[model samples]
Target: MNSQFWDEKFSLNPNLYGEGPNEFLKEQLSIFAKGKILFPGEGEGRNALYAASLGWDVTALDQSYIAQKHTLLKAEDSGLKLHYLVCDVSHFIPEPESFDLIALIYFHLPLSIRDNVHQTFEKSIRKGGTILIEGFGKKQLKYSSGGPKNEEMLYDIHEIKSSFPNIQWEYEFDGIIHLNEGKGHSGDGHVVRLRGKIK
Candidate 1:
């Protein structure tokens, strides 16, 4: 979906996704020390605000201005601050080796630009920096929980591995998992989870 698509979706509710971080992100990031982090497609600043609360300097990017506004509001409510940009992934240019970690939680993209966007994200992290991702697997179409219906937007193990070739994977898995993020995502779902470090 494009920026307008997302903006309309976000505007439909006060908090489209929720005010809490993704479960996988919360679990995985707990293992690492706090540092500079990036969150792409952070719809409601849930993960970004959680990271900031944990003392990480967080930066988030989303094409939806509504998402950006909600994120900033959440940050303010928690007495924390985060850097948020209103721009699509195709236009977002990250500084090389600027972040210690990056998170992509259910951040799906079209097949036309998915690989290029992943490559850009890979280059934004410093060597040894980690990337954590959790997204709908190709099998998610069988469920009505959430995620894009188009298979091209869903992820698989091979697609993810090829997307970040420069990363040494710590763990990668494709399987069924339950999701309970907010009113938007709730139910058993098929997903691909990956965690790796820049080579």
Candidate 2:
């Protein structure tokens, strides 16, 4: 995947996922005190912008330059600011304990680099901080609702748990759920959700 693919898609529609943040992410953030948070693979910055508006120090990363542009424009429109970076998740290396939270909403990656991405992100969160993830489950391929068509890129509970071995699970779910985030993610789909603290 290259920036051009995303640039054209985003250029066609700014609200690919929607203008609002993920509903699951919004609900999960209520329990945490605002602090430094990172959103990896953050496309269009909906979640990051929402966190910024809520007074959280937000940093967003994505591979698409056009995506960053759209997100920053939205941030400006909302009177909010966030540190947005255009970088590939596979190559990103965050400083140790740099984030109070790492939110991965639909942050799917290729299997070749998924493990490394998880390992890199694991060291970025401070002790007692949270890693919240919500993405389509393996069964989502049955639906046309937004998600990778490739089964390998979809979420698997066991593989995900193994990725962040130090996580002390606080909440987890894997089953069918109705989604209405935008035209991209609408209707019933199988999804996995996890909220946990790193030991």
Candidate 3:
């Protein structure tokens, strides 16, 4: 991923992908108890801020320095503190069994490092901790909603499951859904969602 591209994109929009948390993530967090959580490719920090507001210790990462700045500004506005990092998810492998949850919401990555990133994140969560993911499905190419234009960067259920081989899934979905996430994402979208715990 090019940091310059992302920096420019994030710098241009105040609420690039909206200020509200992803609905799937919001619903999942609602049922969980507060604890330490991580958000890789957290973008402008909507999900991270939400978790922090719920009293969870939140750490978020995005490759763009501009993204980090935007997230910090928002966090300041909400009076919430979050540990934000500016780095690619591939370079980040959190301490094993350290996090209560790891959120992978709309965070698309290159095919080269996708599997490794997924497996590492899967192993980083505590026993019985969850990994929640939501991303554009292969069929998203037919939609105008937010996601990578590169098909290889999109999600495929079988591939996703293979990437996190040890997870005992609690729930999964791969189909179309309505999205209204600011100017960056809108209209109908094809998506894949997963909630799983280590086996």
Candidate 4:
């Protein structure tokens, strides 16, 4: 979808996607420690804003300026400070050994960009840093819940393990969850949630 699609959707009398972070993200927050966190493809900044409220320095990156505007508005409404940028993930390059936590929740990517993104994640994470990722699993195709229809965009445990060989997996699994976040994603969704530590 293009920016116009999202802009028009968000311009509705009511909000298109309501407020709040992804439910799986809320569940994973218990593991977060104080540190700089990177949220790639952070549309609307719900997750980034929530992390900032918990004292984490957050940088939310997305391609949509409109989405970034909404994210900033949401952050202001919550009295939380957040950094946002309208940049394509493909061109994003974070400093090496910089982030203590890097999150990739529902940030699906085309195969051409996935390798570079994974490499960036691996290189940017500080030693002992953690990466928390939650996204549609391959099995998600069976459900109608919001996610890319492209199976290539959906991840599986084996694929993740193979992609980030240096990262030690703390946990990786697939299951159904009640997603009550907002309109963009709401309903029982099949997802893969992974937690890994930089080794």
The clash numbers for all candidates, in the given order, read: 0, 0, 0, 0
Whole-model alpha-carbon lDDT for candidate 1: 0.90
The digit string of per-residue lDDT tens for model 3 on 85-120 reads 998677887889999999999988888888888889
Over the full model, what C-alpha lDDT does candidate 3 score relative to the true structure? 0.91
Rank list by lDDT: 3, 2, 1, 4
Worst 10 residues of 1 by lDDT: 12-21
Question: Which pairs of residues collide in model 4?
Answer: none
Clashing pairs in 3: none
Candidate 4 CA-lDDT value: 0.81
Model 2 regions more than 4 Å off: none
Better of 2 and 4 by TM-score: 2
Per residue, candidate 4 scores C-alpha lDDT tens digits across 1-199 of 5556655665662334456776667787776768899999887777888889889899888887777888888788879997898776778888999999889888888887787789888899999998888998888888776788889989887887678877999888788887766776778888888899998
Residue 95 local lDDT, model 2: 97
Expressed as tens digits, the lDDT of each residue in 22-54 for candidate 2 is 989999888889999999989899899999989
Error of 4 at 104 (Å): 0.6
lDDT tens digits by residue: candidate 1, 59-80 = 9998999899888987777799
